[model samples]
Target chain A: METQDLTIDDCWNRIGIWSRGTEKCPSLADVIHCRNCPVFAETGRRLLRTPPHEGYRREWTRILADEKETKPLNLTSVFVFRTGSEWLGLPAAMIREIVPMGPIHSLPNISSDSLRGLVNIHGRLHICVSIGSVLGIAKRTRNGEERDPAYSAPARLVVAVQENRPVAFPVTETRGIVHFTPEMVKELPVTVSGTKAAYTTGILQLGNLDIGLLKDKPLFKALTKDLK
Target chain B: MLLLLFEIGSDRYALDARQIVEVVPLVRLKLIPNTPDHIAGLMNYRGAAIPVIDLCRLLTAVPCENSFSTRIIIVKHQVENSGEVSLALMANNVTETVQTSLEALPPSGTIMAETLYGGVSGPDASELIQWFDVKKIIPEKDFLFPAGE
Candidate 1:
């Protein structure tokens, strides 16, 4: 059918999630979700039919009008992540992989609180550890709280390699990569104590908040320290 | 100036990004019969039919390879009498943008007359990039239907 002949079916709102007092769609029993319905997909296509909004070309022209600022050589790249209320980062080179959250099996006779458990990753058994405790960061509290799925990033297992041996650690959610030059690192305060301070070499300036650039040698040393 | 970098055959070309409206991934186009080789086809751009020109075909006589990096750059073309109309440029390896100084770059010193190239510079002192002129690509040659003209 021609695009002009197409009409929107607002049955989703009339019988779907937003239909609180109205009748529920009989298809809802089988389809389960409004997104699964053909009507929903049909309405989504109409978005492409709409013309580009006013000032779109003007805005693009203005943005590209000025010469682009030259970015400094990215000397070091860190994979910044969050845990509880704290924000931490590890050198991108040290991180082996950011795998999806998997089942962590508890081990017997291991009394250390930091050693989480052994996890099977692609047939290889890697010892999972609570890196937060080793770094002195408190347990994440908001993990249980409901978050808007649209905006929230999912938790992932960060597998960091030290030598040939690999270690797995869970993080609330990852913030991708942050690039900075060596000069951008600021000296950490002398008063800072414990493993967090030992592993953190310097503070990397990220906009307003400072990110602790973990010393790869010391941080990985600590992750596998308890076992040895 | 910021430039969009793309490859056509063995040579790499740069286009001034300021004239660009948007860069979209290569989409299936409706072929128009009896048209020139460079004319890719009509694209249903947000309900409006926009004409696309293949940069590879236009320059090297080779159609742009359907690849991941291939894209259609939408721009406002000043068609004579018909006024401003949206035009889509299909090219390959449009993956990166370059930041070059306006004064730092020297003219290519190419002896070819009526060439579409504006400026030329070697990024690594080995690879020479020629800046592609958009105006020359869509000149007042009655490329369109010539109804309003």
Candidate 2:
């Protein structure tokens, strides 16, 4: 029979036959036989029907939908904080409060990063641990570009209730709270560098930026040795 | 017998595989102060706090240079009523795992009760493998203290 006489069902059947046992279906080039067939046009239009959402919306939904399947609702409350130029997040439930930076009694004969002293919060002494030191990142110094007036950011404490007691972490700046579903989180590859991997639970791609989510329990446990 | 081979500086050392619980990546350690020079710090493994001893420092008094290859080998040993205690040994590098016969292993003399040195022969020649007695390195007293405490 002539190709023009072929029906839409015939075109689809031909394509299915060609696709059998192959990784890919027959391309448009192979479907040249159906070019003049009215049924072919109808079949193609039906197969490629656009949903209510088009272009970027369709693309984004497809990506997000796949992510949703893999990462169901693992609700994570993320508290955004700054460590130098990078923006990072820790679990908000893990965090107890955000306190004003105060005099941190430095313990002698310890690593510079290990701020082993206590800080008074609400008339109670809570151990103040420097997040910079715990993550092995350099302490933000006043010299160099940090001295610029535009670069000046107030330091804040991220008080977290760990092991049934309150522990405070010194952060450079607080960027507010974020809630993440499991689908929004991605693990850090073993090769990714910087302070992200050590304390970061995963990275949440929000808009144009990648926000790091901190693994609080593991990080806190690693930093505080004798925490009762 | 099975052996876990790890590198410290240029030298390769082996430990009885039976004592090892698992091998994990080098993690962020909490540095404890007023401790021996060889003790690097403490690492948290599965909710329990464990001390990490720098194997290079404990053996040669010089600290092991930290790099990507650095790893913490978690080892388990039964101690009296404490049942099983887990300790972490930080090695400069982990090369591979090997199995050999005890008959082929040479005796270690004068290395003390805590240290064992064995010889393994390959087709070419023999290499010295030092079996570390992890239990003796960190006494119970030092294990309880946190860094800078």
Candidate 3:
């Protein structure tokens, strides 16, 4: 057969048939006509060859597809926390640890919006970020409508590793963890306006619920430099 | 180009429109000790500590008087060798953004600068626009200078 007439599909078929012969598998020349094959130069790049059996080929295809799909999931882990109305996720790799919001020593004579207060966590001073303040959402007022008995809860801190350092994020409440598959994530639309989106990685669609996953690395780094 | 036009007291000024990320209302800011008077402090902007500069104070030596119109224009200025430097400017009010051309810029006589006063005229010859030389306003020395300097 003319080498020019052979396609990728034909190469795959030949490799499949050669593998079934069990003659220690056919040589590259016998199976793919390596001598005249224009694609032979690129053949060494792929580590795996096509298996002869129909079942094996299907299984290999599924394995490769799964490997591709699961790679991003390995880099990410879901961290569930509460903001205002709903639960959210921060990537687990990004989280440093959770701490309690204790006495925060405020620095005076500075911009009122700068929440660079100190929180003592296990003997180390961690910068406490006011979630509401940072997001430009109104802070829950003491005098405002009393917290709903059902939803009202004490504040908690979510310390995450941002820019390779630890920074604390103050949340109204802390939900637990929720793992995400690649299928569950979706990019936010540009029409969705807010400063919140800059740090958001994507919207994780969990059944009927939607949680925003935060990309806190850059944010934490920026905060760390500011604190310095 | 997209210009983030804003007012500093009654005077209107503009920085490079491309540098502006967004205009946000005054949020709670944490104060940094031992900084200059014009350095109003910093705000937690999407996890970054964006240094806030009182435009009125930085430009005219007038303290920033917060009002309903008060806003923060987050400007991202790139340093030559260094990386991006993000700072916030306190604007009395955010005005409209006008797409303009350099060719349309009015005569240079309409706007002049001294060592301190950096000025540029807008596309409309009638309107005078001042460039906020943020570097000059907040000198690198000041950032490294210890408190009370």
Candidate 4:
């Protein structure tokens, strides 16, 4: 049988509140008007008669499988720091702890400027080195003004194991951990500053920052060479 | 045959594309002490250490300036009875590969030693390209291949 032609007014009046502002409530006057309404019941019956859409089912199944199969990108956690106006990334695993800055007593008659000297942290002495000096990165203020290397504040000491010995690098600033995929890191270009290029494994392009990923082994070897 | 076209300083040169194994992005090189200036350094390619030669420094006195188009061209060099060794050639601004006949190349008056095999003005209105002899760059007589050691 054919379903009744449902008028806009008939549907509107059946919902009681919609009829309140109108001049005439066509279907509202009768108490059993909507309960026995042929249009409303026929509409529900017709919806039940229709078959489910094939495209919709396929889309939903594919979406659910994708959701189940997809996993987050494999990322490596690196601790970022600023030294000599340049931002560098060090693998988090290499860092022992982010200890508060300590007074490094300079050794007399030592030639290397990068060697900041030994610092006592919690009854233990660790050799502190200026990474900025070693990498030949010029020390500058946040305003990019030239900062006297000797008077620069020792913000944090990044203690790392180099050749089984603990070596701490005094950094100007420490910007916690950042994650990056392997694809994000590109090999260090030959054109980079000679000192910086030696220690840098590759470069990662972060927003408004070029993070030079440092190689621990070479850096440590360079820093802690036997004094001849 | 296909020829790999590249620029070293201002001069354009072409190498047999078949000899080229791959083109890698220029990366930082580990300096080998007491080696020649033309020997750029050792680079890790596919976990194997290969010697890289700066073509500009070798061919011309000028050092190759690193640019966006600079590439490390890995080439296969055959040694006398020792087999083939993969060596990376530092090329500045490697442009593209073009089809050129060796017969079409005419003898030029340029008197540079064994390096230049033949010179050709492009079949079209393109720039002049000199055929670069790879064997001359790393001669088996002079170059001692560190056979996979």
Candidate 2 lDDT by residue in tens digits, B25-59: 55666788887887888676666567788888887
Give the C-alpha miss distance for residue A121 in model 3, angstroms.
Answer: 0.9
Alpha-carbon interface RMSD for all candidates, in angstroms: 14.3, 21.3, 27.4, 25.9
Rank list by lDDT:
1, 4, 2, 3
lDDT of each: 0.72, 0.65, 0.60, 0.71
Kindly provide the TM-score of model 4 when superposed on the true structure, using C-alpha atoms.
0.41
TM-score of each: 0.40, 0.37, 0.37, 0.41
Tens-place lDDT per residue, model 3, B42-70, is 66666656567787887678866544346
Q: What TM-score would candidate 1 get against the native?
A: 0.40
lDDT of 4: 0.71
lDDT of 3 by residue, A81-126 (tens): 7766655787776777877756678776645453657788898887
Give the clash total for candidate 3: 10
lDDT by residue for model 2 (A65-114), tens: 24233444567778888765556787777777888877777666566455
Q: TM-scores for chain A, candidates in order?
A: 0.61, 0.57, 0.56, 0.63
- Recovered native contacts, candidate 4: 0.00
- Root-mean-square deviation of Cα positions for candidate 1 versus the true structure, in angstroms: 16.4
Worst 10 residues of 1 chain B by lDDT: B109-118
Among residues 3 or more apart in sequence or in different chains, the pairs in candidate 4 whose N, CA or C atoms overlap within 3 Å are none
* TM-score of predicted chain B, candidate 2: 0.76
Model 2 clash pairs are A96-A159, B32-B147, B32-B148, B33-B147, B33-B148
Worst 10-residue lDDT window for candidate 3 chain A reads: A44-53
Tens digit per residue, CA lDDT, model 4, A116-222? 77998889988888777767787545664567554377588888775578888887788888999898898877677687788998998888898989887887778
- The deviation in Å at residue B58 for candidate 1 is 26
